[model samples]
Target: MKNLNLKSLYRQIEREYEELRRLNKRELEERKKIVYAQIPEIKEIDDLIKGIGLASAKEQIMNPSSDSLERANEGIVELRTKKEELLKNAGYERSFLDKLNSCEKCKDTGVQEDGRRCSCMENRLSRELYNVSNLSYTLQRENFNTFDLGIFSREIHKEEGISPRENMDMILKISREFIDTFKINNDMNLLFYGPTGQGKTFMINCIAKELLDKNVNVVYQTAFTLCEVMEDQKFRRNEINDIKYRQLFNADLLIVDDLGIEVTNSFTAAGIFNIINKRLLGGKKTVISTNLSPNELTKTYTDRVTSRVFQKFYPIKFFGEDLRLK
Candidate 1:
């Protein structure tokens, strides 16, 4: 999984907020309208706090007086109480008032976070990610029903050891179990290695879709595309540091579709190893779909990478003839 693009996370958040508002339409509209109407005043409220924040900083640095600190504390308490009351009158909860999913440390106006404008920091990072890609399509594509297992053939399953329906039954059950118990079981680092058009990607998507519905963060990228992006980032170093390095290595679950297709090189090898190794170390789950068999991958990459994957990843060798015949 590449680092979770925060833009994707923000888009998901906004989408969910909208969905809930839509769901609660009868009572939500007036409350929502009031919040929207007050949006313009957010700047004014934010401006009002700077003086107090500045004084508190100065006191802490120069005099370190309990008196000035107490006053600053009183100001915060009063402002927050007013904000809470405002929210209550509007029928919006304190949670909704913190839109931008505001920094939990400082509430909405950025008066806190070590006495600096922390909201601006979070907003800046979010804006950088938002500029990378609009990931709304990726989110929608995770819908489980989008998978048409009919694309994989019955004769193919027989060749592998089961009927098509039997194979599907297991896959479906496993998928559901994975979703139902994800927090406890986590992902198994699934390897859907078998024939082309054998529903490997579809199965991965089914799991991704189910997990996303559970509010799990997920990222999808092909090996080639991921390497290309990483290479560009590495070469440019510091050009784009909006997302942290650990984020790419530690998504709750990442789906790398078509894993063995990237052109093998030292850089690509290291990149792949870093992603797989990091996830495995943290016990995070990854789902990789590939046309390559374990043997093929071992030959292409190092025994180390392949062995680590095979040792940890649960194999779900997809079986079927190409369904194009039917």
Candidate 2:
């Protein structure tokens, strides 16, 4: 998946804040007009408040006495008390004319007074990630809570000596533990490999959702799509594709699903190795799911690539009848 342009994303956030401010201002004006129409005394009270403010400014410039400032403040308060009473009698709240900010803390500015990013900004980033990952719809249907243990047969397998449900139970436990303890610098990678329909992709989705909910940066791509992006960057040399290429390596968690399904060639094989090797060296986590067996993986990729996979990734072999059929 293409990474979102950071500049564009922040620009969009600014535009949203501007739109929210505009909406709030418009709504407050319209509501105040209605209130003034219903209670003409509100207009008079507001005028008095403005007059008091102007008088205080002039007094401060002319006399600059603490007594004069205190009296001005008391006068403003008295007018405000009357205004509040009139608003209450007119069936409106005291702050009815105030700006209705979507986020009261930041006043819909997406930043706090202390210069920290607000939750609204984080939410906007998450929304952008959802769009970039193209997993918004899938995540709704596939998460840890929604995973059905019943779908996996409980009967013991003749060869593996474990039921599908029992094996999945263990996998589920490990997945949960991984999410709870995930660290950017931890050398924890996962390789979920098995035949199709064994719920590998579903499990991957569950992990993705868990990490994403924590506001962790995650870039998910099918092996094919990843290779396509790499190929575009290698040949086309486009600036945008280059940014996406860097993002694949820099994401907190990179999930490359269906690893052996991409159109493998010298370029793709090299690209895959570079991604895995670089991310591992950088201590970034990755989760790769594939239909290839251990031997097939060794034969298909370079020895260095296979060696890193064996050393770095916690291998989880999925073996069960294709759940999609059920």
Candidate 3:
């Protein structure tokens, strides 16, 4: 969590809560307008209720008595009951005029009455953390619930001695286990090496969605994009690139997809090594999916990078025909 800029996050969430409150008020006003137009009696009841609350407050301050408060509460309840009956008779819900709240637990305020952040706020944080990519939209269609095993071929592969569907089923179980054990810092890193269009990226997306739903900070980037972030920070240092660069090391989980697709040179190789080695040393987990085999990966990058990857990462081989062609 180094240099996470929590103050900025708090400010953003506060603005979001303000917007939510404004939206709720606007929606309530629209509802009130429609209700008042249809049943003017309801508006009269509402005005009476308001009057009772104001009068009760003044009476309590002046007389300092409980009886006045009780009487005011009784009057308000009676008026509300009549309003509900009228709305019900007019084919409206009993609570149709009630103020709306997107999250009733926090009243859309992003914080509870007890001064703790709401679950909704955590969801927002997770979304904001990875808003650089189309993660929100991609995750919607690529999560575990949408995973289709039938699309994989059932025919046996000559080399692996198992059908693609069966292999994917096993991989799916492993992916689920990775998510289940994600909270524990067991130094579990996954390297999914396979040909393109074989569901490696899709599997990575599935794991990411599950973790993000649980409020884990997951950073997903293509290998090329990750290198660009490194290059940007190294050559053109700025606050934006600085934040993105730190996130590479600070995120709970880092997913480097399409590893071999990026341009490889001395700097890119060193960048890859630094990310992998740093995360490993810190006990942070990383998952890398690549089209290159272990040997090809070694030739494409430095020996140090390949050594760390092979030693620290649990290699998960994804093999099958191109699923897109199927």
Q: lDDT of each model, Cα atoms only?
A: 0.64, 0.82, 0.85
Candidate 2, residue 245: Cα displacement in angstroms equals 1.0
- Across residues 1-326, which tens digit of lDDT does each residue of candidate 1 receive? 33655567666655654654455554545554666577645335545566788889898889875688888878977776776666667566775544343236654343465786354344434334433234446546645666555554445444467766568767777777777777775546677788776667667767766775665666666777667657756774542442433345655676778987465787777777778878888887777888888788778876576576667877777666664455
lDDT digits (tens) for residues 1-326 of candidate 3: 33557688789789989998999999999999999999999999999999999999998999995688999999999999999999999999999899899889899988899998676775566556557346778889999999999898889999999998899999998888899999898878899998999999899999988987886878888889888889889998866566678778878889999888365787887787788888898988999999998878777775665676667888889988888886
Residue 140 displacement in candidate 3 (angstroms): 1.0
TM-score of model number 1: 0.60
User: Which regions of candidate 2 deviate over 4 angstroms?
Assistant: 1-10, 16-130, 261-263
Who is ahead in lDDT, 1 or 2? 2
TM-score of 3: 0.64
List model 2 lDDT by residue over 1-326, tens digit each. Answer: 25547788789889989999999899989998999899999899888888888988888889776467788789988988888888888788988876699888888999999998776676566446436456857987999889999999998988889998999999998888789879735677889989999999999999999888887778888889788778888887755566567777877788999999354588787787788888888888899999997778877775576566557888898988888898
Residue pairs in collision within model 2: none
The most accurate candidate by TM-score is: 2
Number of clashing residue pairs, candidate 2: 0
